[model samples]
Target chain A: MKATGAYEPIFAGERRKRLDDVFTCYPTKRAALLPALWIVQQTHGWISDEAMTEVGQVLGVTAAYVKGVVTFYTMYHQHPVGRHFIQVCTTTPCNLCGAEGVVEAILEHTGCGDLGATSADGRFTVIEVECLGACGFPTAVMVDDDFIEGVTVDGVPELLGRYP
Target chain B: MGYPHEPHPKETLILSKHFGDAGARSYDGWVKCGGYQALKRALAMDPADVIEIVKESGLRGRGGAGFPTGLKWSFMPKERRKPHYLCCNADESEPGTFKDREIMRWTPHALIEGCAIAQHAIQAEVCYIYIRGEFTEPIAIMQAALDEAYREGVLGGNAMGTNRRIDMYIHRGAGAYICGEETALMNSIEGRRGNPRIRPPFPAQQGVFGMPTTINNVETLVSVLPVLNEGAEWYKDLSLGNPKSTGTKLFSVCGHVRKPGNYEVTMGFPLGELVNDLCGGMRDGRTLKACIPGGSSVPILNREETEACLLDYEGCVEQGTMLGSGGVIVFDDSADMVYQIMRLARFYAHESCAQCTQCREGTAWTVRILERILRGEGEMKDLDLLLDLSEQMTGKTICVLSDSCAAPIVSGIKKFRDEFEAYITGAKQPVAALT
Candidate 1:
């Protein structure tokens, strides 16, 4: 493999120690892959090909294998996203409670234009997610770590305002 | 207790007695509420005797499959050559289900105690509570509770001052609904893609790390505490004369209801009363039209069927649906059945691991056909195509996900054919946008 540009490694010094700490929780080193990827995602908003390679090297798994696990789950971002990532629930239960309209409202307010795309300002990226498991409070939206429930079309603007 | 509301008089609260109580989440608070006494008592008894008590209680798996909880534990070999494992499935990603989230959030110690009890019963040293990534608050709360438990000697090398070793850890799932499946969950823990494996050697035989494992739902494991304390006969008697289904279940009611939250009721509770009285009925003057009594996977029930239904495994089966996870989704007269069913198909399509051809192509095509109908671009032939496609999707995949996707499609077409016809006939306006 040839190096394209300067690629900073994630697991080093204190970061490597953190990965080792995660390793103690699991019986196998391969079981630390999920937590390892989470550490990468927390440090860097998205996972790049280089980061996958680094994770594979540290966990003794292949890069292709790491990518396979990453792509299988929807939470990991392959590319960079906006500062505030918003995921609105639009499953059957949420849809019955006008969740689609909330999605439209979120797009219109965030200026993200569509689902899975970030706004030109790079401040917001809104996407539709399947059930955030807070269906009792319908139209649950997750802005980063904040799980806001019972959101309505009118609440989109106020919700986005607080995020900014 | 109905989480966001006060406890109803009709409710039989055992596992959910401390749902909204913040104090119950702490280690000391849990002991104050009589928590670890069950674990202490169980650790002294023979593991076989513990399994027998649970079996006598008639507790079934709360996570969709109504398998006997004790029978699942008893499957573990008496002489454990390899390590035994216990996995508590906290991945509550089913569309209408949010009860497990509450269980971890408010009553974290209850789940911890339950897992400890289950670990001893199954002869497992380590228990992994697999929680989904989206539950950030519950994860934080549960992690803090675990730390406190370790500090207080509730869980450690010598758990509860006993000679046995008991260790518990939280394994966070990234974002996959299919990981809620038992086999798929084991695969996920092994750092593999979340796909359901073909089972010949089930989890109990060859499971996570190739060890004997017994996986129980968050609710099922937590119920063990009450059963141990109050006795299995008392727990069994909580049922409304339903010998097959015992104990109270937490029904996470959502959509088109007055009070949308988690409600705990005894087995064989009246579904209509749960909706009308407990949930405050269909949100003021809005008439109920349809309901998915179980989670999103089960067949949808029409108004009359929903009213006639009972909140139990056998009762739900009698009404042409299964009590899956007890995630009751209500729909009112204003809801468009065609559009809602399309949304459900899209969820299954998104969540499919795509390991099987039927699920991969079938879920995608199901969504496409449903979208066409919702867009009013479908013909009468499309419905037949959907029915035919659904037949192929069911019972063909390694997992029931494909069949789950087909349940509502087949049931919706059968019970609410007029809704589909209205969209095709241009009697109803197109609601879904074409991508």
Candidate 2:
């Protein structure tokens, strides 16, 4: 079957070699699927259908199977997200510590206007996430790869400045 | 030790002694602090002996289940037919739990050393520390520590110069709360969707590529090093005379507390004292109204239960909850019980894997019901309907995700019915906007 879109392959050259090396850790070739998908997300910021097909091809699984795994996880963006995707923990623990106000402050400061919507500048995308596993440090936020803890509504502006 | 703060005089620091010290993050610094001594000692002793010593220490899993750590280890096959796997469960996504994160962030070497000892005890050549991807810093810190361990011959073909071959790797998980479950964790490591598998041929018999596998919580394994080093009796005596719940457990205190952080205290410590004295009670003039002593999955505790509660396994059980993961979430009188309960419901509804029909339907419906109650649209009939839905949701799924959704709802209704009734009766204002 011909490829669906103009998707540049992620697992090629050195990246392909890295993916191949990951296979050594697991007994089955299929076991490297999560790492393979992560490599795609890290490189492309989202997993397009064509990229899912490509990952399926590499892992000897169907495109539907790859998409199935991709959609199951919250971190993997199916569509293109902002350059900096910020997930704020607003669960019960964080909520008790005024996480909602922090979310509101982030949505306002990031110019995203709403949760999950990218700002007009395409600089930020903010969303309320479940627990980020740092409950003791309430109102934890993750701006891309950075896991920041003890974030407050008052500090959202200063924090966003550091991000951009 | 209450991390990010001074250790309380009452705290018994076993696994969290080097929490705030940045030097303890590296292998050399850890070595200077007498770090790998437990692993060195374990390498000399028989793996069976190591397992026996841990079993006698009365150490239990800290990942919410409270399963006996040593008992879980002994379940692995005595005669290893296939490659046995040891998975260190570092996927700490529980809403109120953060102790494991501290262990990984600060004492990376201690965890690696613990994994090394565990790998030896379980007769597994390979150990995979499955960490959640959200923990970028902990992952980087642990990866550096693992790299240092390999360079220093602590984890490799000939780990610590021992003839036994042990290889430890990090399998990063994409965001999935269900992946914290042991079976789901194995499925995730296998590059599949993180779905919980049914038990019958449990992980001990067939797990992770259909081999004998032993999965343990981060706190559970790290505590093993101390058990082997200090002898089982000393470790057992660390608890306040609780034979069932030995050793000092790290309780992550958050929410309305004046001082919130990971507090390490001996078993049988009073929950009231930990909240009032150690955590400095509620903020300002607020009084304690509610608490979830364990992770968010457990039942909520009322003020009376909160004050009289013990911090041990049996003590929590007596109060109609479990000392699960030791993540104490405090709530002051200002907290809205009905709305907060709805938020908890929403978390489970969002996290459900949807494999089990009950969890998929029950969690979503529970959230809807709770949201309806929070929106002042609920009637008294809806309360019983919520109870009925919760009853059906419990113990009817492949995993406890559905049961977890039901726990807070059922407990909240039983203990704090007045709050739910007020929402239904329109006495309490609708706080949450319609979704």
Candidate 3:
């Protein structure tokens, strides 16, 4: 749940440059929060208020303005996620395809059920969410931005193996 | 396909047989089906008459808001300065809704032709299709279709050899549900945070780079092509009942069903028939416990309400909810209401757009309380607290995101109190009790 050394590089020169690139497009600085948060999330793996504050300062916006954009969308991570963040789609379509079984397998494997909860070994964190928008490929889970579809209970280990 | 034998309901501007061909996509394919002829015909008529035709069609917004499309178009001041814009809100992120995606993938030309007609109607020179970033493939497909239209003189300068020159572009959102909202979508298209703007001058008055603009959903505009071709009366009779809400709705049925996909059914079909017949009912002989008539935003309907309810705008309103986005999510007997609520609470908590203090703090509170109840650490007071917080969150924001998140929880707890109470009392009950 805490920021680690692996994520420290995100606050460095290149990430800030990417954040700067996103900021220049908006007429006002505050409008850059969502895209800045996305870049920070991509580099740091999650967004902290500190990261949000940094983004606010860089974009010449208030921390409150940055926080508002960060929390609005489900995709942004506010806290430290596991090395691999597994988002299992439990929306109507994926649920019909036995998304519950995928959730069960994930919980059994990770020993954590809460969103943003890292496993004891810091391997993975499982979050159940609404539709990921790939309804045709039902029972889909996004493992660190890559979608694995038609997931079954038996496929948990293999799905996790690709990450760690 | 033996899907169902339900009679086709009345038609409207959007659901006419003009582009109903399942395999319709190419510019030639659409032209063969009499597509951009509406745009050409519309270009020849006075722009006001084009708006009049839409007004005569009684076409309501197919997006969740259901605002009158003609009225929305009319809001754009004709005397406004140059560079009026038309934005197609293709950012379909509602939990159970997938109708737009199918249209984009299978009938891209329908959407393009509709956009052309809409641009001609509004006298807008530029159109932007703000698609969700998650729709990677669909966006590419749409872009390709735009290219094809340009190549064939269907789009871009001198569209179909007319004096009106309208160009279209596709801009993708990184990932934000609120961007599905019109104002937020304009912001996203303008390369800004997708947080919604306060409305006084609605998008019609001031939108997209501070010019007069009109935003319509993909399905809503696509329906226009058929309306202009077949006339308002022909389109109006497509629905089974309800003149206000006429047309075949693409109901995306999901959860606990044997046959779950986009089933286009006319308005006023019984919810029971849609599920039992079109959706082939619940799988494994399980009984239906509850249903979310629309997307995650609508109130959950208990089995009796679900069975008796009709699938239409007025029908759902009569049952104390709106037919929002036509996302029918069915839950079976084994489903856990407490856990389900917790999931919904978490989603709202994650997606609060945290601008206002009430939404930010209240959504987190709702999530915490729901999590406590689901974890069996809840007290009776927690339920009251949850309701109180949800009440405070509603109607206290710049956008309806707050209300959309709160409406279902307040209704869910009120209608399914026994389920919450059972979690508190630790009692064993029948599968039907929670629903």
Candidate 4:
């Protein structure tokens, strides 16, 4: 089973070491699915079906077991996205601050809404999400991984324009 | 221009009356301000009386569940052989909810004092604060306050010279949202994976090493301190709305609004006034599109319905949604229902504890279908499937997380089916998802 992706070599050895540490942390190997998926996603940008199967094998569980976890949570992405994954907070707190407009602005600029879809030019993929714990800064969106607070419809183009 | 800042509609609750410097987690500072007097008053009364007082005050759990605080405390098995436990759920992970963190950050003593009162009432010898791992700074603040309590002979064994003994400790979770669920929080405190357990043996009966446990949210517990001090009558009068729902609630308003911060407002206040007047109206003069009155878990409210909705628990329920954690997210005209549903689905998909098969698979299915639709690759049947899957997922899990995830998808489709249909026809892309 060609479980390893092309990007695996970048952190293959380190991933293996982290996998071992994860096993030691938990009494049961099956419990390590989340942390292991995090490590793989950090290394590969997203979790592929192949990566899930590989993680299941290393943890002595079934591919279905890992897939159940990977798919259940929003943090893990299955397909590749843009170099920068922009997740705007569309939940109630952020929505009150024009989170929807900020999302619209990003989508208009990027042309992709799902987590894995990239823009035609491969610049960005805008994913609208619930609250990001920064409700104080409403209409907040996380660019790549850093939170960009107080984003508005007009401010979105200026923000993304700088990324490329 | 930057978003406008609205002054708090009411005075701060636990953060009120800081006599000295802003940073006062020390025992001496809290004592000078009459901190543990409530604990003294609580200990002097019959434990049953304390419970009765809270029950009479109509204080609901500030935790997302909104269960009756007094009723929850009274659930302890009186004849249970093992010692009862009070687990303070400081694991505040809900997306728009941050009131607990602010309480812990500003008035850690309020939580510590609240824990002492709960321990006395429940007759529990030990209490543990289960905080989220990401709250590194707030955890330190809690620890310092706890340590000061210990130094002053207030926390460990024979707290405040009462015959009863209560000890408090801090346990940090490894960042799982499910841990916010009471049973899952108990499991994590016991050093297990943060997966939720089934109710009916609800934490009140068997919890934390097979002993009786009562889990209370940080804000809920802190509210008790003042309720005990000023008496239940004062708390009941603090409400600006229905008598059943008393006291002030910290409404965390965000999105599209000019001022988006935590505003403590009386229950039953008009939603329109709070949004347009309090939040300084929608930014850039955009038209209001929709809103999620509570946290993301509750159903979304369209512009017409939300305009009439009030910022209280009953008001929201009357409008076919809930005041879940009081996280109000607003949206403007540029907002797209299709993209909004997809984003919310992704959050539920990511946070499912995976204990129950239905919630485990159902959340993922919701996200996958939403992902396909947002990609402009949706079929008409997919919308029906999204609704069907959401129905299957609700109330069929160990925790409410499943229902929380499914509610938005069901509501999103019900309220915005046209948006989904429009996407299929390739007529107009939602402004929010227009890339």
Candidate 5:
């Protein structure tokens, strides 16, 4: 987990205006925490301590409070990840339908080698996630913003090929 | 967007009637298909009358618990002395349930219209649809639909020129399963960690922003459309037999099934037919070993119990399970019951909020014990120890996440003791170390 240096302000100019617009939607400015965190992640690959402080300052909360909220959620990465983040659903429903084999294939092909590890080439970071809520489509893999369903061992290479 | 299979003859299809139709996602398409008629008519009637019609229809909550939907609405302050809020639980993170995802994807307008009507019924000016963050597709679709609705004057300060303020917004969750609980959802919206709050000050009393709030599941809110459109009697008559459990329910079939999708059938429908006929029955020749009739949170049923189970609130209780989200996970003869049980335990262990000692420790300890047993290092006493731990886990937490972990472990050991015994006795080979 390498830290990308030179932390810059996230809530600036257009982004600050966007956050301002969302403030009217909620009765409290603090309620925009989740959406603000989402905006930070959408801009930067991961959230750092410095970003947390900036977000806290904007939302009128503390950096420690922002950190507490970020760590509680699995989606908010604290450090930089590979260019493409892969979350494979290995919950019971997916596991019952050959999700393990698919995980094996993804690791082997993506070269992530193990769960929660980034590939040596810095292209992929694969992790096993619990229930993507698409149990009907077993082994649902969310690569970055894409929700790829019905993936199989044979389709691993073709699936990742699109990302590269 | 079309589902692979056609609607089975047994499916009644009211809420799912417009599924797979791309046009139904738009505001215009929804209006053309008689969608907003309920909201229009509901605006003309007294809000109490709207709640009464829903109460008369007997439509219960679909997001587990099966509580009466209209009764839940009536809990809100009727005089509107303070600001009232409505929460739409679109965080469909329950393991086996995904019908709400389809609703937002194919029929976004239905959810918005339902929320608008619910806002009127509960006398709330603002509504928030709390959708899980993982649902990027549904969120975008729903956001687009909402923009269309606002542009068309269907929802705003003066909704449809009715002079009633109905402001609906979507609040995205940040990957916490416990937030699906009503109180936790409120806290999450307040920019705090998704920890479930203690009850008895309930949501209707103090909710998001510490005001009177009425929260309902995405499916439960959408079901109100049929009750208002076709009248309460028509929806009440759709049930198979039980008057207590009325109207159609969407069952999400997954696991070792041939044709897996959301099957909308009336209440009191036989589970056997849902599995055998509608789901195309265990592949070609594979016989059913077990089934989790509800979501993974509910107890598992053995083959005989599954075959005899009925798909209703009362019928499911008789067979020793609750109709929780109606996410049926089928297991074929080839499934390893011991390993599958371990996976469910791991899911809860990872999702525990750590606020409650029972859930935080109980879920992790249960996973460890199950892993040890799977690793071929268990005694016969381990089974009893697990049961003891499960008892401690149940009813001892702020939320049911730990109890959810205990359900499958307890039920799995009771129904499939032979499988557990086989692993202990070394009759079954130890599985390879999983990462």
Candidate 6:
């Protein structure tokens, strides 16, 4: 969570303006906490302790309060991850299909070797997530921002290649 | 019409009429398909009359509870006292429901029009469509459509020359299944943890920001367009004999079906036909083992009950399940009941917000016991213990999440006692350890 060199501010210049625009949408600055955290995550790969403090300073909330909200939601990454974060749906609907096989294939091919671990090559991180709300397309996987449908075990390599 | 499959002859596609059509995504494309006429009509009519029309159509909420939509809108103060808010619950994360995702991606304007009409009816000027963050494409599509609506005079300070203000924005949910709960959704919108608040002073009385608010599902709001376009009775005629459950519901069918997609069928449609015909039956000659007629929150149905059950509110209740979100998850002979039920419990356990001790403790324990049974390490008394815990979990929380976790367990043990007993008696070998 600590910065390597210097802790540059996240809400500066254009990002600050974007946060300000979102502030107008809400009656209070604290109400923009989720959107502000999203901006931080979208800019940096993940949220850090310093970044949480900066966001709290902007919204007039505390770093501890920001951490509580960030941890409550799963998408807000609290630490660093691989370049491409992969979430495979293993809920029952997908599980009934070959979703486990898909997850296993992803883990083997990505060299992550385990769920929630970034691959040694630092290209991908794989995790078995809950339903992505796309059940008809079983084995729905989200690589970074793109939500791919009907992913099968055999298609793991190609799905990984597209991200890199 | 089903998107992935060819439209079945019996499907009455009112909401999903333009589902797979790429042209309907554009604002002008939506207008060519006779969109926005409903908003114009709804705007001209008295707001109370609009409520009356929807009530006459018998359109209940499609977001699982199946509460009457018109009755819900009526709860908002007769006059606009303060800033009334409209929350379009696009946070669709139920295990088997994806209808709202398609509705937003395919026909964004349909949702926009529905929101505008609803805002006018409930006298709310600002609406926030709280979509889940996982839906990256749908969120972009909706934002683009909102831009179009604003530029084209369909929304803004003077919407379509009506001189009434209606503004809509998208509040992206980071990742929480519990946000699908109405009260939890408001908390999420306010940038707080997604926790379900206890009800008595309902959303209608004191809602988001301490003002009156109303929330509607994506399907429920889109259904508003048709009832206002065609007369209420014309829409009501789509249902089978049950006057209580009218209009076509989009059932998101998945798991072991040949043609898995959203199938729009009139209420009271037979579940057997939906699985056997509309979805092209069980996958490749596998015999039907069981079906979760609604989403995972409701009870599961065995093969015989699945064959005879009707796809409506009253009918699902008669079969000992609620028509929840119209998500039909099919199971074939090869599927394992004990393992799959364990997986469902795990989902609830992971999603529980831990605000209430009963849910936080009960869900985690349910998963442990179910995992034990799956591992062939369970004793006979564990079955009785699970049922006893399910009783305690059912109604003892701020939300029904604990109750939802207990639903499949209680039902699975009742319908497939042999399955659980097989694991306990060491008659069936334990499958590889559950992940």
- On lDDT, the leading prediction is 6
lDDT per residue (tens digit) for residues B375-406 in model 6: 88899999999999999999999999999999
Candidate 4 runs further than 4 Å off: A1-132, A138-164, B1-6, B9-21, B430-435
Q: Give candidate 1 regions above 4 Å deviation.
A: A1-5
Per-chain TM-score (chain B), model 2: 0.99
Kindly list the per-residue Cα lDDT of model 1 for residues B301-387, writing each as its tens digit.
999999999989999999999999999999999988888898899999999999999999999999999988888899999999999
- Quality of candidate 2's docking, in CAPRI categories? high
Displacement of the residue B93 alpha carbon in candidate 1, Å: 0.8
Best of the two (1, 3) by DockQ: 1
Give per-residue CA lDDT, model 2, range B1-435, as digits (tens). 798889999888888899999998888899998899999999998889988999899999989998988889899998878899999999998888999999999999999998989889899999989999899899999989988999999988888898779898899998999999999999999988999999988999999999999999999888988898799999999988789999989999999999999999999999999999999999987999999999988999999999999999999999999898898999999998888898999999999999999899999998888888888889999989999999999999999998988989999999899999998898988875563
Q: Which wins on TM-score, candidate 4 or candidate 6?
A: 6
Q: What does chain B score (TM) in every candidate?
A: 0.99, 0.99, 0.93, 0.93, 0.99, 0.99
Query: What is the DockQ for all candidates, taken in turn?
Result: 0.86, 0.88, 0.24, 0.20, 0.89, 0.89
Name the better of 2 and 4 by TM-score: 2
User: How would you encode candidate 3's per-residue C-alpha lDDT over A3-87 as one tens digit per residue?
Assistant: 5555344546887776666554444565555566667777778888777777777777788877776665567778777888888
Question: Which candidate model has the greater TM-score, 3 or 6?
Answer: 6
lDDT (tens digit, per residue) of candidate 3 on B233-337: 766777777888865677777778777666776677788888887777898999999888888888888898898898788888888887888877788887777
Q: What is the model-wide C-alpha lDDT for candidate 5? A: 0.91
Which regions of candidate 3 deviate over 4 angstroms?
A1-86, A91-97, A103-129, A134-137, A142-150, A154-164, B1-23, B428-435
For candidate 5, lDDT tens digit of each residue in B255-295? 99898889999999999999999988988689999999989
* Candidate order, DockQ descending: 6, 5, 2, 1, 3, 4
